[model samples]
Target: MEFETKYITPDIKLALFEGKLFKTEVMFEHHMLVWFISGETKIIQADATHIFGAGDIFLIPRNQLATIINYPRDGKPHKTVAMHLTKERLKEFYTRHTAVGKLQPLQKVYRFSKHPLLESCLASLIPYFDLGDDLPPDLAAIKIEEAISILRSIDKAMDGLLADFEEPGKIDLTDFMERHYMFNMTLDRFGYLTGRSLATFRRDFKKTFNTTPQKWLTEKRLELAHYQIAEKKRKPTDVYFEVGFENLSHFSYAFKSHFGYPPNALFKDRD
Candidate 1:
């Protein structure tokens, strides 16, 4: 069974998901704070895999795809709390504060070390989970501020992560697209990430790739899917969504159209 609780305010979201085993992949839209209340989990980013258990807390930055594996630990259901901080809120806070300009690039994920204040802040929210969607937005904002305050005291790095709210500067389009093609987001999102407007992104993308963004994405995703299914022995159903196809049927149709055979033929030929 999949049980998820989503509590949202204008700038912050408190969420919970309970599932025994599942693989989740998505491009994060906001800065995320995650706490595991029960279960063992694996977080995969590119070639890296991070494993954690109950009582673990970590942070992830926005604009990247991640694969999360939730599995039961010690005969208990997997449960976690996730908090998302919107860019608009971060920018508002950053503009009012001047001290954050002298910070460095922050790490993508920061595992919380032992901190009494952080623990206390998390503990205070335990009772609110019972209130569910009825929890007051102002109270939720206050709690989020409290958590950020605790983070600020621990390291100057927090300031950089939270306050560096400007849009991404112009980056190499080819490099950015290659690394981020798996994310199933709109052209505008891609444009923003590459520091271009929608028109400029399309113009630049065509110049660099000699193709439209949508076409390039479809081809790239299909190529990767083919490699996984043919070389890595992965099931099309398992990797279709990860590679950015909307559903299994659509993925199969496209796969057959591209390769002149269904994906299952790979395994059939191997045998």
Candidate 2:
């Protein structure tokens, strides 16, 4: 599988990804708006999975973890254009548009229901992708504002989601860990997200979960992987990395150590 992703700007990315099915765990540092041009994606959040097809648009809030499953559709490569709104850019917009409204409570991910205005706005960005040249930052910024305007026309909540330019505060550790155990990220990242220093994070983690963070994460992921292979009939190779193990070898070893058998044995037992 060949995957090509070009960053048209620090904030805009054009991706052409194809080949076999693959999973990517993304912890978004910036709020992202995605326009799907071809193929499909299954966006798995902590609570729900969102399926998007060609011409679909969605917005993901910053500081959220999502696993994206990308695969070919009708033998065509998956293509998507994503616009990222950095905190600085969002702050600028918030200042420029004073009446955008008090921040509206919003979900972590918002899927725009079918709307012509939103579709048209996404379509307008295609020409820039086709230009084969760097997208001018000013023009890209204008497009971002245009997108926000279109979304606002659809739902006023867009104002709060886009205009409130604050980083996530210290989140609940239990909730965050329960939602993000599958993500392969550093312990430091986990600490930061939960708003703690590394040492405090470890100390607090032991108090809350009664286990080290690493051990808890491994057990949690392994438990889920066991269900997928034994009950759901998923392939071990497919399930291993998705469960947060860095490699098949490590996963296999750990599975055997924990379950007294390899993942393939679970599949065999299921068979």
Per-prediction TM-score, please?
0.78, 0.89
Residue 254, candidate 2: C-alpha displacement in angstroms: 1.1
Off by over 4 Å in 1: 1-14, 18-29, 39-53, 65-78, 86-101, 104-107, 113-117, 131-138, 269-271
Lowest summed lDDT over 10 consecutive residues: which window, candidate 1?
8-17
Question: CA RMSD for every model?
Answer: 3.6, 2.4
Model 1 whole-model lDDT (C-alpha atoms): 0.75
lDDT by residue (1-271, candidate 1, tens digit) is: 3666644454433444455467666567778877777788777665456887878878787765576767878877776667676777666655666545455546367788435777677666767766767888688667777777777787666887777656578899998899878767788888987889999999999999999999899989999999999889998877887787777899999889988998888888776
Residue 112 lDDT in candidate 2: 74
Candidate 2 per-residue lDDT over residues 165-219, each given as its tens digit: 5655677889889988988878888887788889988999999999989899999
Residue 12 miss distance in model 1 (angstroms): 5.2
Worst-scoring 10-residue span by lDDT in model 2: 98-107
For model 2, the superposed segments whose C-alpha errors exceed 4 Å read 99-105, 130-137, 269-271
- Per-residue error for 216 in candidate 1, Å, reads 1.4
TM-score of candidate 2 on Cα atoms, chains taken together: 0.89
